[model samples]
Target: MKLKMSIVDAFADKLFKGNQAAVIVLERWLDEKLMQDIAAENNLSETAFLVKEKNDIFNIRWFSPLCEIDFCGHATLASAFILFKENEALTSIKFYAKAVGNFEVYKKDDGLIQMNFPKREPVKVQEFPNELLEGLSIKPKEIYKNVQAYFAVYEKEEDVLNIEYKSELLKKLAPYDVVVTSASKNREYDFVSRYFWPASGGKEDPVTGSIHAGLTPFWANKLNKNILVALQASKRTGVLFCELKEDRVLISGKAVQYLEGNISV
Candidate 1:
C-alpha cells in the first residue's frame, strides 16, 4: 500500500529551525500497530495521522517512536499546514483527538497558524522527587505539575540554558516529562523554555507549542500581561506567540515544509 506524507518544520519561519513532524492524511484510520510502526520508521518526534471527518473537521492522532502521545502541538500545526496548503481558501479547521477533545486551529491574516488549547495551569508542588533533583545539573527554585509534565521554574535564563540532563535519571519520571523555564533576557521574547522528555518523544524538543499552554498562563500571571512571546532555547530554537485567553491559550507559529514523498507499506 502507498500513502502520502509530508515533513514540516513547525514553529519555524524558515527551514531546519523548528521541530519536524511527519504528517499523513489518511482516508481511514490505520491499524494501531501500523501507525506506531510508521512513527518509528519516520523517526520524527511526532508523526501526525489525520483522517477527515467532515468539511473542515478531522480526527488526528500522534505517535512517537516509543508510544502514542496525548497531545502534540507541532504535529498538529504541521497537519494544519498540509490542509491549508491544499485549500488556500480554508481559514480554519477543527481537530478531534481521542485523548484531548475538539480543538480549533486558524490561519490568521499574518500567516501564522493559531491553536486554541485548554489552559493547563499547573499548581505549585511543595515536594520534589529524588529523580528530578538528581537528573539536572542545576536545580530549579520551584516546581509545579499538571497532567503533562513537571514544570521547573528557574531564577535566570542562564540557569535554563546551562542545565544538563541525566537522561537515565530523568526518564525515570516516566509517563511525565520535565520543563525548565525562565524569563527571557532577550527584549524580543517574554519567556524562554527547554523541554526534556526522555520518557516520551526525544531527549529535547526543538520547539514545543503544547507546553506553552502551561507556560503561557504561568508567565502571563508572572509578568502581569495576557499576551506574551516565548523562545524555546533548544539548539535549533523556535519562537512562539502566545496569549492567555479566558479558559484557553492561543498559540501561534509558522511552519515550513521540509520534504514531501510517498510511503509504502
Candidate 2:
C-alpha cells in the first residue's frame, strides 16, 4: 500500500530545529502493529496517524518507537499544518484522540497554528522518588507531578541547562518522563525546560508541547501572569507561546514542512 507521509519540525521557523514528527494520513485505520512498526521505522519522537472522520475532523493517534502515548503536541501541530496547506479554505480542524478527547486547532491571521489543549496542572510533591534524584547530576529545589511527567524545579536556567542524566536510572521512572525547568534569565523567554523520557522515547525531546501545557500553568501562577513564553533549551532549540485559560491551555507555534513523500508499506 502507498500512504502519504510528511515530516514536520514543530515549534520552529526553520529546519533541523524543534521536534520532528512523522505524520501519516490514512483513509482508514491501519493495524495497530503496522502503525507501531511504521513509527519504529521512522525513528522519530512521535509519529502521528490520522483517519478522516468527516469534514474538518480527524481521528488521531500517536506512537513512539516503543509504545503508544496518550498525548503529543508537536505531531498534532504538524498534522494541522499539512491539512491547512492542503486545503486553503480550512480555517480550523478538530481532532479526536482515544485518550485525550477532542481538541481544536485554528489558523490565526498572523499565520500561527494555535492549539487548544486540556490544561494539566500539577501539584507540588512533598517527596520525590530516589530514582528520580539518582538519575540526575544536580538536585532540584522542588518537584511536582502531573499525569504525564515529573516536574523538577530548579533555581537557575543554567541549572536546567547543565543537567546530565543516567538513562538507565531514568528508566526506573517508567511511564513518567522528567522535566527540568527554571525561570529564564534571558528577557526573551519566561521559562526554559528540557524533557527526558528514557523509558519511552529517548534521552531527550527537542521541544515538548504537552509538557508546556503543564509548565504554562505552573509558571503562570508563580509569575502571576496568564500568558508566557517558553523555550526548550535542547541542542535543537524551539520556542512556544503559551497561555493558561480556566480549564484549557492555548499552545501556539509555527511549523515548517521538512519532507513530503509517499511511503509504501
Candidate 3:
C-alpha cells in the first residue's frame, strides 16, 4: 500500500532547529505492528498517525522507534501543521488519543500552533531512585514525578546544559523518562530544559512539547508566572511559549515542514 508521509520540525522557526516528527494521516488505522515498524523505519523520536473521525477532528496515536507513547506534543503539533496547511478553512482541530484522552490545537494569528493540554503537575518523589543519582554527572537537589517523566530540578541553566548522562544508568529507570530543567539565565525566557529518554528509544530529545505539560506547571508555580517562555537547551534548540490556565497548559510553537513523499507499506 502507498501511504503519504511528511517530516516536520516542530517547535522550530526553521528547519533542523527543533524535534522532527513523521506524520501520516489516513482514512483508517493501520495495524499496530505495522505502525511501529513504520515509525522504526522513520527513526525519529515520534511518528504520529491519524484518522479523521469527523470534520476537523481526528483520532491520533504516537509511536517511538521502540514503543508507543502515552502523550506526544511535538508530533501533535506537526499533525496540526499538516492538517492546517492541507485545508485553509480549518481554524482548529481536535485530537483523541486513546492513551491520554482528547486535546485541541489551533492556529494563532502569529502563525504559531497552540496546543491545549492537561496540566500535569509533578509532585515530589518520596523515594528517589538510585539510578537517577548515578545516571547524571550533577545531582539535583529535588526530584518530582508525574504521569510521564521524572523532573530533576537544577540550580543553574548551565547545570542542565553541561550535565552528561549514562544511557545504561538511565535505562534502568524504565516506564518513566527524565527531564532536567532550571530557571533560565537569559531574561528573555523563563526556564530552560532538556529531555532524555534512553528507555523509550530517544536520547536528548531536541524539543519535547509533551513534557512541557508537566514542566510548565512546575516552573509556573516556582517562578510565580502564569505565562512563560521556555528554551529547550539541546544541540538543535527550540523555544516554547507557554501559559498555565485552570487545569490546563497552553503550549505554542512553530513547525517547519522539511520533507514530504510517499512510502509503501
Candidate 4:
C-alpha cells in the first residue's frame, strides 16, 4: 500500500524550529504490525494517522518510533494542519481514537489548530523511587501518579531546563514516560516542562503535548487559574496555550507543513 504523508513542524512560528510530526491520512485503519513498522521506518517522535469515515468524525492514532502512544499533541496539530490544507471543506476536524479514548481537533480562523483532550489529574506522592530519581537528577519537590506514568515537579524553572536524566536507567523505571515540570515564576509563561520517554523508544522528546494534560491541571490548581501558557523546553522548543476545563484540556498551537509525499511499503 502507498501512504501519503506530510511532515509538519508544530508550535513553530517559523519553519524547521519546532517539534516535527509525520501526518498520514489513510482510507482506513491498517493492521497493527504495519502501523508499527511504518512508525519505526519513519523514526519520528510521533507519526499520526487519520482515517476519514462516513460521518464527519475521523479516527486518529499516534505512534512513536518505538511504540503506540495513548495520546500526542504535536501530531494532532500536524494532522489537523494537513486536513485544513488538503480539504478546504474540512474547516474543522473531530478525531476519535483508541489511545486517549476520544479527542477532537478544530481549525481556527487565525490559522491555528485546537485540540480538546482529557485532563490527567496528578496527585502528590510521598517520594519518587531512586531508579526514577537517577534518571532525572533533580530530586523532585513533588511527585504525582495517574493511570499511565509518574510525574515529577521541580521547585524552579531553571532546574526544569537544566535536567539531564540518565536515559538508560529512566527507561527501566518509567512505565511509559517521565515528565519533569516547574512553575515558570521567573518567566512570562506559566510553566516550562520536558518529557523523557527513553523506555518507550526515545530519549527526550523535543516537545510533548500529551504530558501537559497532567501539567495543566496541576499548575491550574497551584496558580488558581484554569488557563495557562506552557513552553516545552526541548532543544527545539514548542509553545502550547492550554485551558483546564472540568475534565478536559484545551491545547492550541500553530503548525507549519514542511513536506508532503508518499511512502511505499
Mind giving the per-residue lDDT tens digits that candidate 3 earns over 91-189? Answer: 899989876678899999999999999999999997889999899999998899998889999998889999999889999988999999999999899
**Residue 53 in model 2: shift from native, Å?**
0.9
Clashing pairs in 1: none
Model 1: residue 21 alpha-carbon error in angstroms:
0.3
- The TM-scores, one per candidate, come to 0.98, 0.98, 0.98, 0.95
TM-score of 3: 0.98
Which residues of candidate 2, in runs, are more than 4 Å off? none
Q: Model 1: per-residue lDDT, tens digit, 1-265? A: 9999999999999999989999999999999999999999999999999999866589999998989999999999999999999999999999998767899999999999999998999899999989999998998999999889999999999999989999999899988899999998999999999999989987988888889999999999999999999999999998999999999999999999999999998
Whole-model Cα lDDT of every candidate shown, in order: 0.93, 0.94, 0.93, 0.85
> What is the overall TM-score of model 1 with all chains considered together?
0.98
Candidate 1 lDDT (Cα, 0 to 1) = 0.93
Candidate 3, position 95, lDDT: 89
**Model 2 clashing-pair count:** 0
User: Candidate 4 vs. truth: CA RMSD?
Assistant: 1.5
Model 3 score (lDDT): 0.93
